[model samples]
Target: MHSRAVFMLLAAFALGACRGPKSDCEGSYESWTGSMAAHDWDSAYELLTPEFKKKVGSPKRMAAYMEDSWKGSKSFEFSPFDIAETNAGVCTARGEMRYTVKIRGELPKDHEQVYFSYVFRQEKDGLWYIELPGNERIQSF
Candidate 1:
């Protein structure tokens, strides 16, 4: 009876461990975007893959680039319209986002709307990380 109980417990744990992200892809994408929208660059950078970090040089450089691009932004909004995952541990999220940038020395704000698609890959650690293109920005953007 003791051996049976131990086997059952191990089986349960194995099953739970095998359960991976499917619908949760959107959730992961939201967490990353939320960090960026809040200007929490460090938190946002943590969601990227190691390859992306190496390509960007370092976390500080990545943050600086984001700051420069979003310099005059007053508000940002993002909504994921579609999220898909493959059995190979690759996922893609497509969304529409807008940023309201306050023009320097001007009263008016510039609203830029962009459609973006991001690729995420699940690594050996069972955590999903953002996979960015060589140019950084999404192709549709």
Candidate 2:
């Protein structure tokens, strides 16, 4: 009986380890930003919540915007900091991005720095997704 109880305890511990920690929300955000910096729009878009997709119009439109905005950029960097949870299933991530753009033939090159705050929602699937700025109540902040 004692050996059986020990086995059960070990099983429980293993199961808990398999479930991982609750910090996946931060991991998701990091993955999303990494995708964006790599110019992998499809992967980045996949990280956005359904509601955000609707507000942004469409996946194609989102990709177009990314392409246009980053056009002619030599390098892009996004540093996410101050990630905190605001409520259940809701978290906010603030960051700054810097990129350099090379202009052709006459126009001077431009270097841009932008500060951003984004909301992320933890869905029923236990994954976090970006909540974009929109008419949605999630954007009230």
Candidate 3:
């Protein structure tokens, strides 16, 4: 009887561990965006789904691209947020993101604005990853 009780308790703990962190889809996206603002490449990569990292192939490559994209700007920021969920519980999010960068030999800072959307799904592991709505491309900063 004690052994059976122990098994049940372990099972309960396992189930609880499977539950993902308490974060809405938009919140997750914003967390990633915040990482970008701080130029925290590692933190930004951590926010990506494993699938996304696979698609990008390398953290160094993604970080280089992000740096290139923002080279030459000031007061860069992104704002406005929207999130929607499908009947199947999949989520779609849209927002305006901004950035400021200064490139080599540039006299003035450049600001960039992007209107973007992301589709997300809960993996069997109960974690959410960013997936495209239609295309398989995992878009990220």
Shift in Å, residue 122, candidate 3: 2.3
TM value for model 2: 0.68
Superposition TM-score, candidate 1 onto the true structure: 0.70
How large is the C-alpha RMSD of every model relative to the true structure?
11.5, 11.8, 11.5
Write the residue-wise lDDT of candidate 1 on 35-113 in tens digits: 6677666666777876777877877988898889777776778877888885466778888888877776878565656
Model 2: per-residue lDDT, tens digit, 31-138?
Answer: 666666666666667778877777677768888988897777757677777888788888888888787776687564656568878777887888888765443254
Ten-residue region with minimum lDDT total, candidate 2: 14-23
Task: Tell me the lDDT of model 1 at 59.
Answer: 72
Instruction: Evaluate model 3: give its lDDT.
Output: 0.61
Give the winner by TM-score: 1
Supply candidate 1's per-residue lDDT for 33: 76
TM-score of each: 0.70, 0.68, 0.62
The window of 10 residues in a row where model 1 has the poorest summed lDDT is 15-24
Off-target runs (Cα >4 Å) in candidate 2 are 1-23, 56-58, 106-113, 134-141
